[model samples]
Target: MAGGSFRKSLGYALAGLAYTLRTQPNMRFHFGAALVVVAVALLLGVGVRDLLIILFAIALVVIAEMFNTAVETVVDLYTAKYHPLARVAKDVAAGAVLLAALNSVVVGLLVFYPYLHAFVRFWARSWRGGN
Candidate 1:
């Protein structure tokens, strides 16, 4: 087919997502982490703009990981034997994932710090029998 129908295209895209979730451990971990982050943000009552920023950060990390997986898969398909160029390609992709993950961590900390601090202070006061 030159170009599939929109529904067919969506199906194919979903299949790829399923395949990635099924086959990639890192993807699963990212998904789990994303769920936790979202839950915590909601619990902390993060503002809409900050929540959106956190979501974007999470998406960036996941997208980077998916791209890294694609690069590794393609490199493996291209050469079974060790090659410097293939190694470089895989390493670069991994670096991108690392950077994205780091960015997400920074965003999470920045977004959640004040909320967490207040939560801790409130709990501490309760423990000390303070009003």
Candidate 2:
């Protein structure tokens, strides 16, 4: 095999995605979180531009997570036993994911905070008998 055709490459990419979803707990969690974020944005009727930003933020986190998983897997393959450089590599990859996650949180807050506040206020008013 001199390499795969485009369709085969796409299938292989999907297989890699499935493998990550299956084997990586954090990947699963990130995907779940992304789903929730998208759902909330839809419910809140986010503007198109904000929706795009939210999508970008979610993608960044997921992409970072995938990259981090790749780095960890390659590092482990390189060495079974503990190694300082492997630890460093894993830690740095994890840090990249952390940064992405944090950035997503910031974007979410920027986009959703006012809507969340309005939601809370509406609920509060309803609970207080429209006072």
Prediction-by-prediction clash tally:
0, 0
Q: Which stretches of candidate 1 lie over 4 Å from their true place?
A: 1-4
TM-scores for all predictions: 0.93, 0.88
Error of 1 at 100 (Å): 0.2
Clash-forming residue pairs, model 1: none
Name the weakest run of 10 consecutive residues (lDDT summed) in model 2: 1-10
In the range 1-131, model 2's lDDT, one tens digit per residue, is 53558779989889888988999999999999999999999998888999999999999988888889899999989999999999999999999999999999999999999888999999999999999
Clashes of 1: 0
